[model samples]
Target: MAVALSTLVEEANRYLNCAAISDYCPNGLQVEGRPQVLRIVSGVTASQALLDAAVEVNADLILVHHGYFWKGEDPCITGMKQRRLKTLLKHDISLLAYHLPLDLHPDVGNNVQLAKQLDITVEGPLDPSNAKVVGLVGSLAEPVTARDFSRRVQEALGREPLLIEGSAMIRRVGWCTGGGQGYIDQAVLAGVDLYLSGEASEQTFHSARENDISFIAAGHHATERFGVQALGDYLARRFALEHLFIDCPNPI
Candidate 1:
């Protein structure tokens, strides 16, 4: 079954409530392709490898959490940018990307999905005052040692995360995926025993140590893999389109 490209994009935008969320890049259709869509390939990023894989599969559309044309990016399409755009244009495959929308989405959001993967029962937003803080505060079924929690994270993400052990066991936890380590302070303010994010900054260690909060920096790619897959499955089920999740793994 095939849905029109416009219909698919419209439904996706509406479902994700893209207009309500402010993002670094455009949320809906980034690259225009064929009028009708049948197969969709979803991934964390629209890297050259993913594009090539999608083309090999004859995907009609490529869906991603990271897309082109960022706020401060060079407007001129050259070098890597040129090649990426060329792939989409050459194969006539539409590119659809959602950044903050995917992270903030309540049902298919990365934060919520990560919680499910880690068996954390979500409580509330990490920072209630800041809507942009897509990280969440949650709790495990029972308290576990910081080391044990880190082991669980590694097991779930298939990557050993950087662990900054705290003085206490982990119970109330907070997390945000994909470069959200900066939210550690907010997580601390929420009084979580531990906080997890994609990439850890230099200051993250200081914050974790000083505040006595456990910190884990899981790979950004590994942490963000779930949202796009969930969104793709949703669209596929909603529109009866064939969907494939292509993981072009990245160490970072």
Candidate 2:
């Protein structure tokens, strides 16, 4: 059985429950191709490399975290953007992207998935008021030393986490995957002992030191890979389609 593009879009929107919010790009079907989809390819970013891989696999649809037509991007189709769209259009391969929706989804969201991997029982969103809050807060099953927790994250994600330990052990932890250092303040205000994110900025170091909150920066790509993979597996099972998640490693 083949699924229509519109059907897939509707299913994904409902699954993520991010239809109510305003986002930088169109949430579903940014570039339409075939009406019926059988084979679906999932990736973190809809880069040229990923598109090429999709083409090689004769993918009917490409689902990704970062899609084209983002706000503040050059509206004109010129260089790389034009080439990417041209390939999709030429091959009649549909493009679907999630972005913030994928991050905020409770079950398969990046933050929630990371928490689950680290054995953190999620309490709630780091900022309950913001619908787009990508960070999450939770308690560890048992309190462990900051160093031990950091090592656990490293082992789980297959990358050495950058740790900035404070004076306290970590029982309560807050986390957001993929360049979410901006949420450190929210984590601090939420009274979390440790804050974990994918990337670390210069200001983040200062924030951790001054605020007395432990901080860990796991790899951005490493942390985010889980949610999309989980989502792909769910879709594959639900639709009975051939879905494969192609991972392109990123060190940042």
Candidate 3:
């Protein structure tokens, strides 16, 4: 069944509370295509590959975590941006994107979703003072060695995580998925023995080793795939529309 494009956007805004969270890019309806959406495709990023997959699936709307028109980006569309925009325009497929809003949602947010998958008991935000905390600190079900913890992350996400040894035991863990390795320091201050993020920086390894906190660099695309998929599944069940998740895997 086809649902009005406006209705989908409205629900997304309400569900994500997009207005409350400040984002680099617009949170809803980045591109307009069809009046009604019969089939929707969701992905981690709205890259050329994901868009091409959406076209292959004959998607009317593409839901994503990352969208175009970010702050500090080139104002004019040139080579890559031009190609992506042209494909969406030529194919008449809508694009719906949510950035921080998707990451900060309590129930379906990336942080919470990852904690659930990793079997960590939620404690609270890594930084409580920050109104919109995108990262969370929690305790594992049982205390495990740093090696054991890394193995769990590898198994759960279906990817080998780059591990940095911190301590012998890891009971408490903090995480912010998708290029959030920068938050390892904050997670350290929060007293978590382990810090998990999608990407790792040179400084990240040093910080983890020096601060006595275990670090896990789980792929950015892998850590972030859940939120968009969860949102798509939710919208699908709520409105009785067809929803498909197109995985355009990225090692980074």
Candidate 4:
């Protein structure tokens, strides 16, 4: 069965509540192709490798958490951006992207999906005052040391995380996936004993040492891999479309 690309985008926007949230990039149908879609390829980013994979699979639509045209990005379609767009246009594949909306979705969100994998019992948003807080504060099933927590993250994400130890034991935890090292301060203020994020900034080590909070810099791609896949699977099931999740591995 085939579905119109516009209908799929509408369903996704509604499912993810895309319109309500503000993001740096446009959240739906960044690049339009065929109106009718039968096969979809989903991934974390619409990089060249992923686009090639989608083309190989004969995908009619490609969905991703990260897509082209960011807020401050170079508007001119030259160099890398040019090549990426050329591939999509050449292949006639529609590109559907969701940024903050994918990360903030409660059930299929990056934070909640990671929490489920790590056995974290969520309590509330890390930034409680903000209605659209992307980061979350939660508790582990039981208190574990910084080392043990890092191990848990490694086991869950299939990649060993860079660790900054804080205490002998940790209970309360806070996390945000994909380049949210800045949110560590908010988590610190939220009183989480341990904080996890997709990537770590240079200041993150000092922040952990000073704040007495543990930190784990799980690879950005590793941490964010689940959300887009989850969203894709849900859509595939709902729409009866054949979907494949392509993982273009990134060590970062």
Top-scoring candidate (TM-score):
1
Candidate 4 TM-score, true structure as reference: 0.97
Instruction: Encode model 2's per-residue lDDT on 73-191: one tens digit a residue.
Output: 88999899999999999999999888888888878888888888999999998998885677889998888999999999988989898999999989999888998999999999999
Model 1 scores a C-alpha lDDT of: 0.95
The lDDT values for all models are 0.95, 0.89, 0.90, 0.92
* C-alpha lDDT (0 to 100) for residue 106 of candidate 2: 79
lDDT of 4 by residue, 166-213 (tens): 864989999999898998889888989989999999999999999988
Report RMSD (Å) for each prediction in the order shown. Answer: 0.6, 1.3, 1.0, 1.0
Better of 3 and 4 by lDDT: 4
For candidate 3, what is the TM-score? 0.97
TM-score of every candidate relative to the true structure: 0.99, 0.95, 0.97, 0.97
Error of model 1, residue 167, in angstroms: 1.0
Q: Any residue pairs clashing in model 2, and if so which?
A: none
Off by over 4 Å in 2: none
Model 4 per-residue lDDT at 132: 57
Clashes of each: 0, 0, 0, 0
**For candidate 3, lDDT tens digit of each residue in 147-175?**
98888898889989999988559999899
lDDT of 1 at 124: 93
